[model samples]
Target: MVAVLARFLVPLNSLLAAGGARVSAAAESGKARHPLHAMVAKELRLWVATPTYLMNTAVGPALALLAAVSAAVAGPQALASAANVPGVDHDALAGLVSAAFPWVLGLCVAMTPLSASSVSLEGSARWVAQTAPVPSAAIVRSKVAANLLVAVPASLVAGVIASLSLAGGPADAALMVAAPVSCGLLASCLGVLLDARRPRFDWASAYEPVKRSANVAICVGAGVAASFAGGGATLLAGPCAGIAASMAMAALSVLAWKAASRVSLQDR
Candidate 1:
């Protein structure tokens, strides 16, 4: 009986030791990783692995490119004919469309997967995150960063193409660059805030939150309103108005992010 007990105890002790080593290694690695980097990695992995996210990210750029190519192929004659309509200067119309197109595309790109869907996708992970020492604010910021990572470059590409078509000088090019980036930031912050306000973790599909949620419509509406407002401002005030609008949107984004951070994980 004593021999049998010793044999059992020996294997049990070995198993416990191996488990302890693994736990220690994991803890050490966790400590070594920055919270923001880890969160961004996790979010990117989700975005890459998920079909809905891939579709959401790709659709905007694809549409923008297609429209741009079609417009370019149509030549100035088509545009000029349309510009012949009352109150539409061909140059101004071209510039307005050029500036507004990229901004709207960037806004849509940021709005798609980074907002309600992101929060809902976390689902039970929020519980795990809440139990961890990590701050919810950091998590939120990381999501915003991940969205910007995907969005800013796409927006920049579209904006540069549009700016070239406008034939505007350096200042117009600068406005185009700054405006989309600011719009992307605004969309990201708004997304997180909207999700925090009405997180829907019970969805059967990831696409539901991204495509079907009320927040999507709200965000899209806001984007449209902002684009119109910015275009109007640019019409009245010149390219500087675009810069001013970007600045204003960026300020609002910061404030919205701050408010989102304070929201309870229970809400997520």
Candidate 2:
């Protein structure tokens, strides 16, 4: 009976200590906002700086150039032939390119979440957040804003370059800018939620968001799907449909952020 009591008591003590730690951390967080805001900003800068460099300075423009060259060299007939083989109408090749813009937007969406929360989601860093003075919601909001800071412009620029270089339409360019902006906002919020809830702190694997993170896949997939759907609708009508679709996505994303903010602010 004495031995059994000792074993049970040890485990119970450990549990209580852990709970106390979490409670103390929560109390610390209610102390101030500036430090937390700074941390969030720092995380944002660290995350966005690298990707923004690679995408705006490297990949996005490169892809747009390739697409433009392909469109130019192959002309409509080549596109038409490819489309026919795929059973998707040749004219739709133009539509496909138009649709590709939104997918690029998705890439923008994926950046901040992948970068900002990767480190802090785990042990000590997580504790740091717990002790931050800012409301959890503000911290989350800062991260999302950081995503937009990079994504909105980067995606829009990608569209513009793709249009000018690839000979894409104005409408297509608009879709590119709008689609990614919405997707980026949504993805950023989701990333914070994931980080806070199921942090992959112990993960020992390489962190290639494009390859390893489920968030990346989801962000890109949603962006492409939205872009394509919007572009297809635009092809049937005019740019209005694509514009409307982009607007709708943005609206939904705002609602999502608001919902996420509420959750972040709730008592831990």
Candidate 3:
């Protein structure tokens, strides 16, 4: 038993030592940069290197845009028949499209798991981060910001594409943009909070956090619920419903970020 333990412990210790040295060297070199900027850059590099993260971020918006464009090509008659909105008139179909598009875009933005992955990635580097002189709040904020940076832009592009393809007016276009951007921010913040609530540090693969984590299911459920809520709000409140939902989501995001910062600090 002693021999077996030594065999494993010897190499494990060596690897940890090497990793620590590398982390320390990098920290020294980056001392001149703000910790938040450095952390954000690190998270961004990790995301770019991971193909699965890239795919998850891109697929949602791409599919939403494709569906919007296809619906536009199908015309009002097809949309009315599909939606069962009780009228085949241009106005009814246009209203339905305008109302539905924001929900779809918002849901797509919410499906992004970049924030969850950022938290998980930090698990491997928590020791390094703790040893550095950076505050826990900066670390948490950087992770959330990195995910938002990617998710928000992707959602906005999808919103713009959908609005243009569907022939929505300037107001509709603006609402569409705001809905997705706000949803992405909300999703990212919520993801961080959820992960902080139930963090898993023991993982063999990067995919484990985003793909197999319980947080994934929670985030997906939240996205679906928010999408339904947005649709319901639009039905009851008209085209400006998305703006209202965005406002509520923005407030929720601020709260979630505060919670995440607190949770991350405790974990540290």
Candidate 4:
């Protein structure tokens, strides 16, 4: 019986070894083919490892969605009345609705505290990524992917809420989703670009780079300015506004990512 068992054990070991080899090969193949996916996964894992960062990331979008829904229910007049300001007289209601969704979505994504400090978050170990053989484009793309991974889902939620609230038809609902998604994409690109250009390697705490950094202010300010412009375009373009605005944002996102890829990642 011992001799029979030993013979079987050798075959079993050989089978297991073959299976392991296949799995290892597949993993390496995947890594080689989709490096960006692996990098994005790493970025996401970093967020998860840091409970505070993860909580803030999830909470920001939730609050923004809550605010958006509240604003929708309250209506423009009630909002202005709450602040003792006159009702929104100039902006059309439909346009206001269109603008409000993207406004919140952009603000939420831009305020996520991920992209603006993505590189800086590396701290003293920042040299590892900067010194690696990976292309800068790949680095920026992974950061953008991780950012969109957080923001795009929230944008969809906001879009669905917009559609259920006031959208007239399928086209309207699509525009609602598309416009906010585009805003998220653009915000991610812009935030990454700003941080890549000016990474603050000197910081005592995470807050220094994540919240108090100049990039944070610039990102938030850009999001606000975009909301105003997007709101105006939605007001003026009537039915096609969302489509046009999204296209323009998409273009700008491409430009921003290109610029970011060119940035030199080194000390300071």
Which candidate should be chosen as best, given TM-score against the real structure? 3
TM-score between candidate 3 and the true structure: 0.78
Compute the lDDT of residue 82 as modeled in candidate 2.
Answer: 60
For candidate 1, the per-residue lDDT at 166 reads: 51
Give the distance in Å from residue 216's predicted Cα in candidate 3 to where it truly belongs.
Answer: 1.9
**Candidate 2 at 201: error in angstroms?**
3.5
Better of 1 and 4 by lDDT: 4
Q: What is the C-alpha lDDT of each candidate?
A: 0.67, 0.52, 0.72, 0.70
Q: Which candidate tops lDDT?
A: 3
RMSD of 1: 12.7
**Model 1 ranges with Cα > 4 A deviation:** 1-31, 65-113, 266-268
Q: What lDDT tens digits, residue by residue, belong to model 3 across residues 1-268? A: 2344344554655655675577679878975657687788777766655655555555665565666566557754566667765546766776776667777778877886577656666666768866767776787788789878877777777777667655357667777777778878887888888877777778877778868888877876787787778778876886677678878888998998999888744444
Lowest lDDT block of 10, candidate 4: 1-10
Give the candidates in order of TM-score, highest first: 3, 1, 4, 2
Residues 39-105, model 4: lDDT tens digits: 7877776665554455555655666577668756875555545545345553454346544555556
Candidate 2 deviant stretches above 4 angstroms: 1-37, 45-92, 99-122, 165-170, 205-225, 265-268
Worst 10 residues of 3 by lDDT: 1-10
CA shift at 90, candidate 2, in angstroms?
Answer: 5.1
Winner by lDDT between candidate 3 and candidate 2: 3
Candidate with more favorable, higher TM-score: 1 or 2: 1
State each model's C-alpha RMSD to the native.
Answer: 12.7, 13.9, 9.2, 11.6
Clashing pairs in 4: none
